[model samples]
Target: MCLLLLAGRADAAPIGYSITGGSVDIDVKLDGVVIGTSAGVALTGDSIMMDTAALTLNALRIEIAPTLISLSTHFGGFDEISVESAIIEGDITFANLWSQDTGTPGLFSVGAGPLLVTGSWGATDSTGINAGTSGQPITFPVPTITGIIDASPGLRIDSVTMHSIEGTPFGEAGKHLTIVASYSIETEVSIVPEPGTGLLVAMGLTALAWHRRSGSGAGPAPRG
Candidate 1:
């Protein structure tokens, strides 16, 4: 539980980031039965941090599997178990991130960037059978940075590199099944600031002091 609301006057600083040597590879399926041909997985937390309540629109998704072995006396007698598709990569570094001031004008603005992801997966069986198929689930989608940064006083994210792919097939085709997997991840970010160039430099210094006090006829002076 966390909450913060600042529409003006700055005061929203302190972000974070960290992740190192990520890894994942999975491809195993069962129920629409396919086993013993697809497996690769790795993850144990190298690094991860992005503060301010996950940067507003928070989100974090992580999944890892393996721990099912009930053969039922071999040969055409197995019931269910499944997994497929997963890959993650690592390397992340961000600090202070953004948001010093850039809120409410054309309607809200202030942000920092760098986060990319792409993922997918499906499989669940025990007698409740839930088949699976739809490769490509390793992740990448979140990247945007071109100036405009304050990053909340001081942020940090060190490393992250993950990879995952999954598949499985059993029953006549060289049967020898045994697989296990486990891993997890989820993150979100969004902070704002950067618009109209500080209200056009405060209206160009109040129109250049009203054109230098109306050309020094002296009806304006009074701004120390």
Candidate 2:
């Protein structure tokens, strides 16, 4: 019976967690000075999803500032720019969070890895530089941002921080773009039990019951 119980536990399936609530913070900087900042609650709404079983993310959205940012400095010989429809989409994977903590048994803390960010921007130009075509969207590759993950208290991924600097098409010689973002998410983790566990439990219980019934039915141990 004990062995059966252990086996059932050992064969437990990986958990699946869904994001319940979260917020996003972003900063857009040019030449080490903040030009624009965007902060808002994450619009999960069934669009943004995470799967632990496969270690994949689906349709994650990060919102940027809606207002247009007019830069005093010019990059790539462009000025008086209008930034629109700025958003990020990408995939992220983490170290095993399901395993027991190496330092402390029964405790789990999964570490994070670099975030590969890529997104689109609406193209609109009036004075100096034009980004992509007017009707078409401009797509750019962002640098891999270093990130940290915290799963305190349970299997839920509660907090994340990302910051990095990368070159931009708008940047001229010796100029760069800086991006910093952070996310705080609330999640609920539920386990998906393995199929064989129930069968094993039932078999163990049935064998135990049969043994007890046979013992109780003995007539005074056959009078010794």
Instruction: Output the number of the TM-score-best candidate.
Output: 2
Summarize candidate 2's per-residue lDDT along 1-224 as a digit string, tens digits. Answer: 65566565644444444455665655556767766555653434222333333333322444434333444555455433333444544445423323233354333334332233443333234563465433224344433322222343122332232323334544554777554455555555544444576676677788888888999987665544
Runs with alpha carbons beyond 4 Å of true place in candidate 1: 1-115, 118-163, 167-193, 202-204, 211-215, 219-224
Each model's lDDT comes to 0.34, 0.44
TM-score of 2: 0.49
Candidate 1's displacement at residue 213, Å, is 1.5
In model 1, the Cα lDDT at residue 15 comes to 26
Q: Quote each prediction's TM-score.
A: 0.24, 0.49
Q: Which pairs clash in model 2?
A: none
Model 1 TM-score? 0.24
Per-residue lDDT of candidate 1, residues 187-209 (tens digit): 23333333443564466676777
